[model samples]
Target chain A: MTHELLPSGIDLLDSALNGGFTKPSNFLLIGTPLSAKKEVGLILLNGGLERDEAAIYISTSNTAEEARSHWEDYGFKEQWEEEGRVKFVDCYSKMLSATVSDTPSIRRVPSILDYTKLSVAVNDWCTSYYLQNTPVRLMLDSLSAFLIYSSLQTVMRFLHIFLGQLRKQNALGFFLLEEGAHEIVTFNQLKTFSNGAIRVNEESNMMQLEGYRHGMNIPLPSAVVPKATAEASQVSCTPTK
Target chain B: MFKSNGQTTKVPTGISIVDTLLDGGMPNGDSFLIRAHPLADPLSMVIEFLHNQLKNGGVGVFLVNNKSPASVLEESAILKMGLRDFKRNGQLFFIDAYSALFGLRSNEAYFVEDPNNPVSVSKVVAQALSECSKKGKVFFVYDSLNTSIDEFGNAILAEANTWKRIAIAFNAILCFIYTEWNYPKDISEAVANLFSSIVDLITLERIVATQVVTVSKNEGTPVSKRMVPIKNAVTGGIKGYVPKILVTGPFHAGKTTLVHTLSTRAVSVQRMGTTVALDFGHVNHRGFTLDLFGTVGQPRFDPILERLGGEALGAILVVDSTKPEEFPRAKEMMHKAGVHGLPYVLAANKQDLPDALSVEEVKKKMNISDEVAIVGTVGTDKVSVVKVLDLLLDKILST
Candidate 1:
């Protein structure tokens, strides 16, 4: 019955987070424009991959090819994909393009409007990893896109079911939303469901950890960014409490 | 005047359940659109098409666009399609449209240098058809028309129209792998109308995800509208995949034991031999993977029953034969679990006990109808539990 927290791959916040995010909980990441929210997601996923855990990247805006290139640009090679340690649920491709093919590591969802199919793809990957007893960490890049495609009520209901499914498999979930894209009411509604949130400030490059026992506001390093990624000196092996 | 022969002039789809659904299969010179979800891969069905074609000595040509021609063959080989041998004997050919998009030089003989031009693609397809589709039931698989349509926009529909005419002229069975990406209604209807039949690869969301194939449209055959749950892999092309099966009854009725006995692998969330949460087990029964979910039989935990019963294909109600008084509770549990109306079989469990009532007595006590199968079983015994499962599976499949 002991709880475990996996690393978030962000070094400065680890000391305050007591290890990282809760072992199996829905996490809200507030991303200001030009913030490294997506990079944090990829790095957090990399943290799980380092532990031999399976990771699912739910890309709402980026195509599978574009997403993989982003992963490559960050430093990871195709080996992780070939090994099936990482998977992508690309919801962007088929919306505009007619003939997009899926690789073993990458799956394509029809569109955000078709949330059921999107949910199904996420469930399949979670269940696959769960059955193998492999811990899973899911990253849904930019929840704002979903809000644009759907009503606020619909997205809330989706998060309720989606985060619940991830919790069922003891999988951690990270959903990033642009800072000013949504109203305060909408943000508060989503925040109420999530175990905690990471508020990022693009102006100051600082992050305020909310809801954790020892949550604190910390100034992020210059190197913890999109271009440099986790490959730089920001890479941390800080163990969870 | 010659009377109707009664013999089918139809060609088998190489899928047993699909063939059954179509009452033998599509007639020659017919086209079937195999629409799939973005997450699902029904390419195996196409591989099975070629595999079956080889057996019947029918020639086939697969148009590749999404992926490389070599990858297509490699995937085919995984589905046990010995296409290399067929290629050696000149019975199989691949229209390498995938390589042309990337400008990669392909070693394929029937390669399309530019897939952007619909006419060039059609000409290549026509030439390949002329070469191999001379005799027997010729097969032409547009590996997927989605890619060509994506590149050429709605203009590819005209090309598809042209191919449809050519397929009929050649008297071939045309199979198109069209993954539905939520296109506009007009375009979707245009695509649907072009085919004589449409087979959709659906993602059925259950406790675990399952892929099911159903014939949505057919011009000739009487559609059964049965969802054939399909599993895809490198080894098995397309096999029967039954994802979720439920086992529920009153407390101490041995529901968990029945699940353990039935599944190849099983685990129970329990405290002191009492299931507190749930029991999960899986068994490959009759070429289909049956996921067994055993609900916590305690009435206090009845709240979890509804969640456990989510999209269960079928259920097996395990009741203690010695305790007929508890039959009402067992029946009530089904309703509480939301699996009361689903295809279910009553397992008169603990039948090995000397004081156990007969199956008929158990049925009478429960006031169950004749259609609801009642099978005598010992919960701990694998054979007994398996018999109960088989009965439930029969009820589900026969649906």
Candidate 2:
């Protein structure tokens, strides 16, 4: 299988992101609670799915069924139910099912280092279906929720190993984060570990996207604004507060 | 038949209307003592009087040195009674005593555990009255003469007497003694000795019930009284015809998302999955605007969100169709809304997938009151979300 950087295929978005996503690069997406960061992740995943790319979803908080239901509004229900390429690895459910507390236990709940135990189980199941089907994209919905099950350091260590496995397979990756990480020390650690980073902020009515990439910076227009040509400068478009 | 004292005398009724209600103006020069409570509406009378004098282009020098001058001015501004055009004409001189009236390091005096020195009180009052008397026909208003009694002790009466002597000497200065009527016996006696007997015009501020009755007293003189009914506008905060919709339920019940879907704009202080705090949104429906608050499902949340809705609400209890177990929590919110007699609607949200419970199943899980109108919804769909509000309207209209 050949590894290729994935394009969301949304022309404006692809241009803003500098010719689409870079393979094996971990990108950080930050936004106000309801500023639509998760929605962007779902949109990108859906675009990949449309291209027939097998995607793996790792949920730290929500259940697989819940995530599936949320994306139904974005037109992913039928595509997901039909092909099992879009699957969920629910850590929350697994921990609950095993009745093992990451804390107060004789043995600490396994961190990302222990993710191999899970991936091995996943690898075995995938082999039963098809031996060599490599996932094209992997998304960790949120890391903050995972901290509830394990310490930030433990989770980060686990993520380093788990994400290394995805990078070895050349899978595109992105992490969804809440704005509260502005105070947490772990967010900076993630930023240092990632190749690129983007921040989303909603000022009044429009969502603004800004980021630094490879020493070059890109400033995207409001999430819902259209770029106009120089000739159309007479016709101005800006959201009014 | 009284001796012709060569002094021009005027008394402040502390009210503009009563001043107008008393014709062109009252006597100026001599002090007219007004007795009333600290919270008494003496301000309304004083402002209306000043407003009338102001509207007539009657330029008068006013000396005010209250720490809360801004708030007092704001209250007067809202009443539309005092010195509306005084600032524009640049005639109202405000004396902020925040830095110098007291003998302390600064005029920033909050409470007086011990009474103040009479000398300092006399100096501030003397300075204020002298400035107010500079222009001949000036309506000299000393807001509350008694405030200084705590700091000035009985020396305030001597100061008032000295003020009387100066006005007699000027023959054009008008002195008005403004203070709470039922003051401490000592202070009242001291103030009375200086201004009461010499008062040419007396206006008794009467608040009998909500009605304001002004009685102008004279010794063996014909009675001249005026009664005005004061109507209060909406106090505390601005209220409108907009309906308040409170969205609340168990954790992960989609209440915040439902509000965002319904509102034109939204603000949520959320963490990862569950709401660590509250969410807010403003929705303008057909002709009504709704202020929506999505509170956390905890029991302590009731008081904060309840006050946010003020009087009543048009609440919506959001439920996740996929999570029937959360229905009991939603019902508890419904009961609280019922206590306010606020009409509410149930939003059976997340009804897009096969795993989601049907509307009938959700209704059975919740303690659906006869008052609530339940509707199935997909919050992500704008049109479907508006339909839930439509049901809320029908519920409100029926109730």
Candidate 3:
């Protein structure tokens, strides 16, 4: 079966994936502490926004404003926000006992403990965008927050159901998981269901493609060099044959 | 003598809007169900009610379910009545249900050892009600019904019924707060039906936080569908109102000019004398803080306009009076902004110009309905801008 490919926004990464990620595929981003995993996720989302597509960022770690500030550092905030191509599902503020009134593109759920509410909120947003016939890019900031609040079994069930829903909607999904935060068995269980998996280690400033479910054998790069500046323009992933 | 006509005496609730809706206030021997979202704080309304009752020389019994008595007192410190003083004077009492939840013994005047035991809690509440009723009027407030349901399951229905019976027997006023979306549909409906009236405190998702109260069920008279805005307690203990208003029109229609003139602090993103993105302003008028969002008028900027239009409670459509040909574009901009059904006023800008048209002429040329208000004004005039805002606010609140 032929699969449509969407650009991952990072030119080198796109080249590495032959073209880009397959349409409607789930990618697991496993990052160590201080990794540039969030920046990678933002690049993927920026690809959709640049094409005038819709993107939803579900942040379990920070407020929507803070998440947007992080995206601003990547130079993708103003244009996407102005065009209304980006939406935020904030699950952090209420946990801190802050009341977040809903905005046009931001929905705040009361608590992350109520995964049911979060599920319903995400389902509603994806379904609405799907009905609009718009391609959707979804990013779940981190799974570590969910694991901390709920049991491993519950998180697994939620991700399973959520990924299924995204697949049915034909939307791309990026899920970030912190390394060392969970058991290897738990990480393996999540990675097994993903179409692609990448591990980011910030201490060495290196990224490796651990696996790809499609069996597309792309040559692995020996090392990834880090750029000196923090600007999005300065960062580039160089491939070493 | 307080008159009673087969019904309990009506007392004044601190909130004027609620008192008007309830004819005077909640009647004695009655219970009211306040349906609210869990995140939405209905506790403020209860605090105001209790404060009024206490001020009126009535005794109050606060049934603390989820929050501890200390927490409740801390929150009510805004009342400025000295909760400790009231408790010492035997005018205020607390039935602590939260202490047992934390496995700690409560040191309050009335403590329920086992909150999960509905029978014991109901008995304690009934005894408190009887004692408090010995005073002129007794006011009872159940901090939450959802917590009780969580603890005792279906037994909460029986407990609520017992509370109703006790309230009627002692001629007391009772208020029960329930969070929506927490329980099953049938259970919430069943609980709502058990009350004499239901006041739904709804939070409208506008740019500015807007809360309105509506009566879904009332046994006395027909309820009004018109929403009453809830006054937020501002600093210095004054009630203040804040609402969002969208400013939009055709290209070069003086929208940015009007926003700047009216707002004390206005920010506009303009490129070469034309607004490219948006203009935002904040204005304080007549106890209301209006957050105005002015959208780019060009059709190419419709996406931004739609984003800015979301959650606007009202709108101001600015049109240059001399440019009658742009009326179609003005109407299109309003449509793009998604402010069709919301309260809006048409501002005929450049009224000081020689070719400026009158409000009636602009209305006729723009094909505006009579229901919509129109005001003729120059963009730079403070008086004219205030007039336009006042008219729009009046129409918004009236609606």
Docking class of 2: incorrect
Chain B TM-score, structure 3 = 0.79
| Candidate 1 per-residue lDDT over residues B164-237, each given as its tens digit | 78778888878888766556688777787777788888765443556887887766343566787877755756
Off-target runs (Cα >4 Å) in candidate 1 are A1-221, A224-241, B1-8, B205-208, B221-224, B250-287, B291-311, B335-338, B349-361, B369-371, B375-391
Ranking by TM-score: 1, 3, 2
Candidate 1 Cα lDDT to native:
0.76
What's the distance in Å from true for residue B274, model 1?
Answer: 10
Query: Could you say which candidate leads in TM-score?
Result: 1
| Per-residue lDDT of B298 in model 2 | 65
Alpha carbon lDDT at A227, candidate 1: 43
lDDT of 1 at B148: 57
- RMSD in order of candidates: 9.7, 28.4, 10.5
Error of 2 at A1 (Å): 12
The positional error of residue B101 in candidate 2, measured at the CA in angstroms, is: 63
For each candidate, the DockQ is 0.08, 0.01, 0.05
lDDT of 2 at B140: 51
Interface root mean square deviation of every model, in Å? 9.9, 35.1, 9.4
Q: Which candidate leads the pack in DockQ? A: 1
TM-score (C-alpha) between model 1 and the true structure: 0.66
The residue pairs in collision within model 3 are none
